[model samples]
Structures are given as C-alpha cells and as structure tokens.
Target: MSSPKQRHLLRLGLSCRKISAQVTNSATESIVAMASSTEQEFMPHYRSKLTTFPRPHRFWDANIASRVGEKLGFRLTDIGISDVEIEQPPLPTHHRKLIAPFLHSVKRAGISVYGSEKFESESQA
Candidate 1:
C-alpha cells in the first residue's frame, strides 16, 4: 500500500501474504526487517520444508511473527495459548521524517566533509 517496492519485494520473496488485509476488532502492528535476496530466495524453501507440521518449526524465529502465518497457526486451536504477549514500541508519530532535516542540513553545504581533517578538533571528555 505504500509504494511499488512492496510488489517487487513480494515477487522476489514469493509469499502467500496478501497484498491487502483486514483485521476485525483487533489491533495490528507491522514490523519490517531488512530482507536480503539470499533470505528471500530461501524463505519459501524453508517454509515449504515445514508445511506438513501444524506447529512452528523448531528453529522458527519468534521475532518474525508478523509476516508468518502458518508457523503460528497452532495457536488458533482450542488448546489455548500461554506465555505470549504483544510487544510494541508505542505508536508512531505524524512527523515521520524526524532525522531527514538534520541530514539535509549537514550535507547541504557544497564542501565535502569526509576526510576534512583540517576542521577536526579534539575535545577532552
């Protein structure tokens, strides 16, 4: 929903993940971790290896829960869940690009700052 990058990444990643999702009376959080081509290339194969099992793979990462469905499907059963809690880092702010202006100010000057040892000064801590 954000941009075309999602489509490209998903195609290369080849997920059964839906392009659009709806949650009913539930709060949802999205977490995006850097996905290397190597990881993308192997995720499908790794997931395929565990399709027959109804529970999480023995080595399945707990942090990647948001993007994985089948690995956590066993929690849906009537057996009940234990020792799991939702963790969040507070809600996001409206001003999304907080550090961009600082970056722009630093690089806006025409002079190249890298290797400019002439301007460097030591400060005793």
Candidate 2:
C-alpha cells in the first residue's frame, strides 16, 4: 500500500506516459520539417484556428502550456494572450527551471513548437 502522496505521484506518472505515447504515435514528421515547412502544407489555412489560454504565471500553468503546445504544435508565442485585467507576476526562475525538463522531454519525443506566424497568415486568409 502506498501513501496518499505516493499514489498521487503514481497517477501523475501514468498520465504523463499516456500523453507521451499519444504524442509520439501521432508525430507526422521530423521536428525540423514541421518547424520550417509552410503552414499551408501541414495545416490548411481555412482550417487553421488560434486558441488562447490565460497567461502563464506559475509553474503548473507553464507545464500545462508546454504540454498543450506539444500536443497541438502551438508555441509559447502562439498561445499567449495578454489580459490587462489580470495582472500576474512573472514566473519565478525556479518555476521556469521546473518546466524545462518537461519541455525537453517533449522535444525528445519529436514534438515541435510552431511560431505565431503560422496562424497569422491563416487568420488573414
């Protein structure tokens, strides 16, 4: 029998593995090609859409953003939408350090981050 904390950690680890498997199975091409190819070739302009989430101000938010980006091919710059009403402090360096490992893991799994320009042209069209 495990302690509550141990059980929670097990669950988290399992979830992470599931997500990683899904991303790896769905990987379409090399990260380099995905990053450099014109957006039209991979994602049709008419079908492209931008989805925004709250600005990340915490380590957890950063983790969520990184995972979402990996799954959807959205970069940090692509998903950020400023909210003047909600003024949050900048993420601490410690939090950034915590998020780095996960981001690197996604890269290792062949997930690429895409620039905002990918969506900008789509929106214009």
Candidate 3:
C-alpha cells in the first residue's frame, strides 16, 4: 500500500500527462527533459538493483547490502550490519544452522540486528 503522499504524486502525474497533451511543443519538451534528467539521476540505483536481484526482498543477505550501498554512494557500514555477519532465519535449516549459534549469542547480548530487505529503500525519502 502506498502512502498518501505517493497516491497524491500519482494523481499529480496523471494530471501532468493530461496537461502535457494540451501544452505547446516547447512546454512539452521542457517537461520531457525534466523527467528524463530526474530518471537519469536515479538510473544507477535502478540498474544496480535490477542487475543484482530480481526484487528488494533479496537483500536479506549481507552481500546485497554491500552491493546496494556501493550503488547508492554510501558505505556498507553506514547501512549497519557487517558483510561477514549473517542472520539466522526463524527455522534452523541446513543453511540457517551455519549462523544460528552466532545469532543466538547476538540476541542474548541485546544487540538489534536488521536486514535492508525488511525496510523501505532510501529512494522513498
């Protein structure tokens, strides 16, 4: 579900498209250029995400965090969680067993651990 702001923006976009159709060539050109430039500024992020993972949900791993941080012009440490650290899932399967003990210790120490996948992207800001 989108926020009210997002819904408003979508409405504004629809209105803009209607207006653009009735606008002069120069006005249309300007609007098109502005939209293109905005897209270009955000292109690196979109491309990196597209090439790295099929969806944002894949960021459950530390590797994705590092890659995403690099693409977003930020440090992996800035996003929290070390690339070497892995979170154990709720059920300790074969793969989860590898990190289960470590996660249990971290939890017992009262340290909070989070994955990028569970949170919204910075772009939303």
Candidate 4:
C-alpha cells in the first residue's frame, strides 16, 4: 500500500519512477565528476567545530541508510522508501563542509544521503 505522501506525490504527477530517474541522472553526473578526481581532490581541509555531541539518533538514521544502501546497492528511493521523512537540526556550515566530500562519495556509490539539508529544504517546500 502506498503511503499518503506517496499517493499525494503521484496525484501531483510525480510518479516514483519519474522521481527515481531524476535522482539517478543527477547522481550519475556527480559520479562522473567523482570518477575523474582522486578522493583527496574532493575532500575539504577543515577542522571540525563540534565541541559537544548530541544523542546518537541525531545522525544514526542517515548513517545507517547510507551504509545499508552501500551494502545493498540500492538507494532508499529504489525500494519505495522515499516518503520516510526524518527531521534533523541543521548542521553547522563548517561541519557540512567537512563532511560534504564523504556524503558526495556516498551518493556517488549509489546511496541516498537522506536527512541532508537539501533534502530537508525540498521536503519543506
């Protein structure tokens, strides 16, 4: 059974397949860029600004999704899990920059970096 959100998206003319194709094309472009560069070329050189850590759940869900997608060779959207929204506080800009390369690599590897700021913004819109 489709979730209400999924049905709503479908009703609005964005089918899952269309969404998947769009995401896949965007990911392919990034993957191609990544393929031409070494890891060090893409990673930012910055010191982490985090002085305190929050509870694990704050980051655990996205981390787990990335890892599982890596292992399974499928993004969350690949298996109709697109509507599972997770809300998280925005990360500091420095933190985002520090992890941007890692997240890019994850996406390049065919995993969805869920709960990212981009996703959050789009979901809210």
Give the number of the best model, judged by TM-score. 4
Per-candidate count of clashing residue pairs (backbone under 3 Å)? 0, 0, 0, 0
* TM-score per candidate, chains pooled: 0.17, 0.23, 0.19, 0.26
Ranking according to TM-score, highest score first: 4, 2, 3, 1
lDDT of 3 by residue, 1-125 (tens): 21222210000011211110111113222211101112344455545655664455321233222222233222222333232212223432322322233233333333233442322232133
Model 4 segments more than 4 A misplaced: 1-87, 114-125
> Tens-digit lDDT track for model 1 on 1-125?
22322211111122223111111112223322222212454466456645756744232222232233222222212222211222122222311122122112222322122221211221110
Kindly report which residue pairs in candidate 1 clash with one another: none
Backbone clash tally for model 3? 0
> CA shift at 50, candidate 4, in angstroms?
16
Query: Rank by lDDT, descending?
Result: 4, 2, 3, 1
lDDT of 4 at 19: 9
Give the better candidate number (3 or 4) by TM-score. 4
Estimate candidate 3's alpha-carbon lDDT, on a 0 to 1 scale.
0.26
lDDT of 2 by residue, 19-100 (tens): 1211211123212111211223323321232222552332233344345334333332243311101112334344334334
What lDDT is reached at residue 54 by model 2? 50
Candidate 1 wrongly placed segments (more than 4 Å) = 1-42, 45-67, 75-79, 82-84, 91-125
RMSD of 1: 19.6
What's the CA error at residue 74 for candidate 2, in Å? Answer: 15
The lDDT of each candidate is: 0.25, 0.28, 0.26, 0.30
